[model samples]
Target: MYWHIEDSRYRIANPIQYLISKLGLSMDSLSQFVLGAAVSTAFLGRKIGPRKAALVGGVLGTLPDLDVLIPFADPIDSFVYHRGWTHSVFVHALAAPILGEGLVRLFRGLRDHRWLTWMTVFLCLSTHAVIDAMTIYGTRIFWPFYPDPVGAGSVFIIDPLYTLPLLGVVIWALFRRNWTSRLQTSVVAVLLGSSAYLGASLAVQRHVEQMALEIFSDNGGKPERVLAIAAPFNILVWKVIGLDRDSYRNLYLSLAGGNEPLEVYTHPRNPELIACLEDTPAYQKLDWFSRGFNRAELVDGRVVVSDLRMGLTPGYAFRFVVAEADGQDIRSVTPKRDLSLRRADAEDFAWLGDRLLGIPAARAAEAGFQSTTRDRAAFDCSTD
Candidate 1:
């Protein structure tokens, strides 16, 4: 029997199903809802009343994610197809006017402020895509015109620092029966604050990238690409990944701490194991989705590929069993999500606090900080 272990906690499902099954809300969705409600309330509140505008805005904000309910052929299709056409700015541009016109006709008060209504709808919709593109998970903002995903990788997916202020202002506005000048100023202030936070994150990311490049070069390592992302909920600590020909380097830096020697860990890419499967649809999709930051391994006679951008070292959020050993040859199989290597240890969260404070701990591998290596000898791909 071909049996593989799966983690039911991290299983993929349609967004609605996943929300219901987990009884939890994703930060991305919450951020979008807050942003939409805030933007609509700020611009359309005076004309259409704050409560109604916020309600409509909240619904529009979640509209783009509706693409998740669309069925795909396979797991790989489902993975890469998300945030594609629906998140596109071009699509949002076309959709805004239609939605805006409908709202104008539906609400008699909004008929006089057609242009403001359209602009508000457009900004509410496009901001969702803009914020999504800020994370490590790429978004195809341009879509059909430019199919590649764009990821700023500056901010973590769920940052309470960025979302809470905007949410507070929205709640305040909702309580008031009428939109006052004071409420309008508060809304504008929070919106600007959120934008400034994003800008600051981008600036910090550039600094980290330059630092990583210099450190890699000083160590006699020529990295092909370097990516820096905020660590979890805070921007004070950064996780940097440097991609090379045969292996990748992972390091963490705390801006709060002054200049300190970085401890870099190297992990094998095992490209040879998947050289034969490169042309397969599953491999290609993963490669494109991860922007070539993917690694392959052979485990239990199965060929697995993992996106290196998400999760921590050794474990990843998206791993797929794309191929299986068939005697001396490898055969492509339907992509099956493999969460056996996914790690979510509570100890790692403890380590994150110390690491963020600039306190050096034991070697990452020994300190239970999501640092480990996979034994390549466990499975052989000599035939490939």
Candidate 2:
């Protein structure tokens, strides 16, 4: 079963779930805002003294991330609530004046400098949500009034291509005098370059989606819609999934191999298994959150629901035993997060690296005949 392109809203979730899972380090939303604040402070921090810029930038920048301490059941709960209301425009605006005024009052020297301090704090804090919206990692920029988190699906959470330029400029600014013309030029250039990079990434996504549409239709798979998300660390390659009701087709498409034929892998959704679970709030939320880009499979006759947006099939980031089927009814239904699955291994990383470097994996998605027998390009897995 596949979803139609017109009917589906292709969202870009955190696509590198497996890579992070294997690496054993996850940078949450707090760190993200802090990084953003550092850059913003580079420009706005001039309002305050140069020496205090880091403190102002770091403290105000990451203040929104304090939501992490709100406490939740597990990583899943943390993910849902971390960037919700806390990252909203209302919170940012409301928190800025209280925080800025409070900081000013506490610092005797800054008691007289409320305007500049408030502006600095506002920019540092407000920009947090704006930057996060660019990453496909859900950010509720509009919170309470509109709870749906907005995602541009433009850039990854942490891409070197985007961060390196900004980091370099920020470092150089910290060393140089505050708001020098040279530093200003450098910051402007970096911002423009990063914006252009995100624009280019979106363009590439469109190209990949178009190619996926054509490829699927040509292969007699009339997909209703498709989502195109880049691989981790880079946007040179992408994981394209064609969605339908009964089953979904997924495959790798490299920007390097533009317009080249790709092999599509099909997996059944087993919607009956998903629908049979009563009192399954999580399953429904997950289904809606994933935008139906999920697969419900039967393992030994037990329903295993996985969020296909994060990792590859059979090993997605979030999977749970939602139900058990007995003829016409589901019983013993229990939604439990299964983190034991090996979503990313040495082989998977190696395979992904090869594909990222224009070396397509030998196994074709649909018919094994096309890309089969191709040389398996060896990738360095020693560090992994």
Candidate 3:
């Protein structure tokens, strides 16, 4: 759901958030359910009237994502709190009856089919969790019972390839006066195609992981973990990360870049930056949540830690000025929002496209980019 911030919700009082709002493109938690509701209503409304079913699906689908509205102390707290308790399965069981009965009372037509209404509400709530679980970001779908998040790492949060087909069907369904035989057939085709696309994406992930692990071995290290995330919009290109005991290694792989050197990039965790604050509760929570794919740097007289999984190396999206430091002796360590990431400009995106095509310009993109980062080739950082 991190990508859901495309005009995403966790803006934290930034200008990009405002710009995205004006742009009318959002991938937030609410927008995702809105997309889900449209598709589900189109399918379920076949037997029931489309208007009523849409009312139910559109409203109910968004209930689970109410977590986004709750503001926490800082952006990191907000990130941790989101997709937590509210997205759990128990919320569905407890909420469906209250929501279903309320809908029945308002609609009057659903009184005779209260069970159907209840089932529809349950479908909306449960599917929200299921869809979130498919992404690499954490979703505590089984919360209260168990506190850990379940991430399948299959898809990015807002793949247009996944949502566009469903959105197309929803638009078509809205126009039909009644669900006909042909309409039902069209609905079924969209559903099947979307599911198959998800399956294929996962398969590609598996292949990418396998190759990335081999690359790690060939580079004189054994991989403890491998994460192959698809690049921004397309699945043809992937950013692969491998973690060893010492550091996390990154590489860009595309379908077109077969059997060539992978141009692996290494980022040391720089545990030295957090040595004094490692025992703090804030550090512990972030460590667990990030699965150790995090790096700390000395920036502007402060020690900052960022989750590398959420964005590419050097300029990650989720950074926190975790501590105040004076020559490596931390005076204080507190979780504070550090919105150092800027929106990807046209040239940044153009570089991404060039990387996808394996062009020479792509190699130059990171040449001096790592000067501000922890890349081994860069100068050694001095906390002083």
Candidate 4:
């Protein structure tokens, strides 16, 4: 199950593998569940009992992510549409009162507290979208009105520091078999702590962005755009990407490593390859989805584009083969997931640990930084 879930290139062999894959992809949902259950238990638990309120909250938390089950035409559609209509703030606002009224009708205990119930339902639904936008992955909160997805990139999608405290409090409240003032206080405290963690992540991101700008400017390179994202499970170390005209720079900065000269790696953007497929739907979708932080390259006669924000250098999480090259002519193909690139290994995590502590290590080359210009010489577009 671990093997299959770790790699998208492998198909699930059995029901267990399929289930594990679903569970693995649902980390964000689990965090949302924790958020919803904790908040609901804090507010409505005294009225409806802790367990029942938690159950309702857990359900509401995962409701937004049900958009995953919506079938799309291809992987690209699934990629861009996963958090579309269902995660919209407008949809949640419209549905909250209806869902709240149903809850009030179902449970006679919530009859007098109609407004409170509606507010809880709305918070459970809307907080999920708000936290999702904090991550690097995009979310469309204002659906019909706003076309572009919002990704603050302040925090990683899964952070133990943010989720664990609230989860622990919720679990304790559930086992109490009775709602008490102590449980309410604890739940509210943890929720506030989690919110503070989120606020700290945004503040740290701004600091990293400022540092990245100073570094780039000192080198006499003005990046068109700069993005700072938290590393895998912690915000102590940030992965910063600077997008330039023909190249993008990748750097890792640790809060502990202050005023140190960091090594920055530069990679080709290969815009000429992307230009060949400008009219293709796949290319356009990825371009808009990644907000221009994408890189294109020709690999083995295939034109591949990658979203640079998600994964390490040379091995991005989202890479698709959008076009095939026959001699000098580029032919658009049905964009297929490119899974030939290597995945992160133990060595990467070891490097992460050292880097997080502000200890200098050998460089990212051992991790995932590899030369991507190998196939560039094969297809010269200077004349084209």
Which regions of candidate 4 fall more than 4 Å away from where they truly are? Answer: 1-9, 12-24, 258-261, 366-384
- Evaluated at residue 167, the lDDT of candidate 4 is 79
Candidate lDDT scores, in order, read: 0.79, 0.62, 0.68, 0.80
RMSD of candidates 1 onward, in order: 4.8, 10.2, 4.6, 3.8
- Winner by TM-score: 4
User: lDDT of model 2 at residue 147?
Assistant: 82
Over 52-98, each residue of candidate 3 has an lDDT whose tens digit, in order, gives 56556766766767777776775567767678888898978888899
The global Cα lDDT (0 to 1) of model 3 is 0.68
Cα TM-score per model: 0.89, 0.79, 0.85, 0.90
Which consecutive 10 residues in model 4 have the weakest lDDT in total? 1-10
Report the lDDT tens digits of candidate 2 across residue range 10-66: 122333544454232234343344455465555555555433564567667666666
lDDT (10s digit) by residue, model 4, range 136-216: 887898898996789998888778898789779878867776888888888988998899999999999999999889888
Q: Tens digit of lDDT per residue, candidate 1, span 102-173?
A: 999999989999999899889888998998899888789998999998888898877899999988988887
For model 1 the TM-score comes to 0.89
N/CA/C clash count, model 1: 0
Residue 85 of model 3: what lDDT? 86
Residue 36 error for model 2, in Å?
Answer: 2.9
Error of 3 at 60 (Å): 2.0
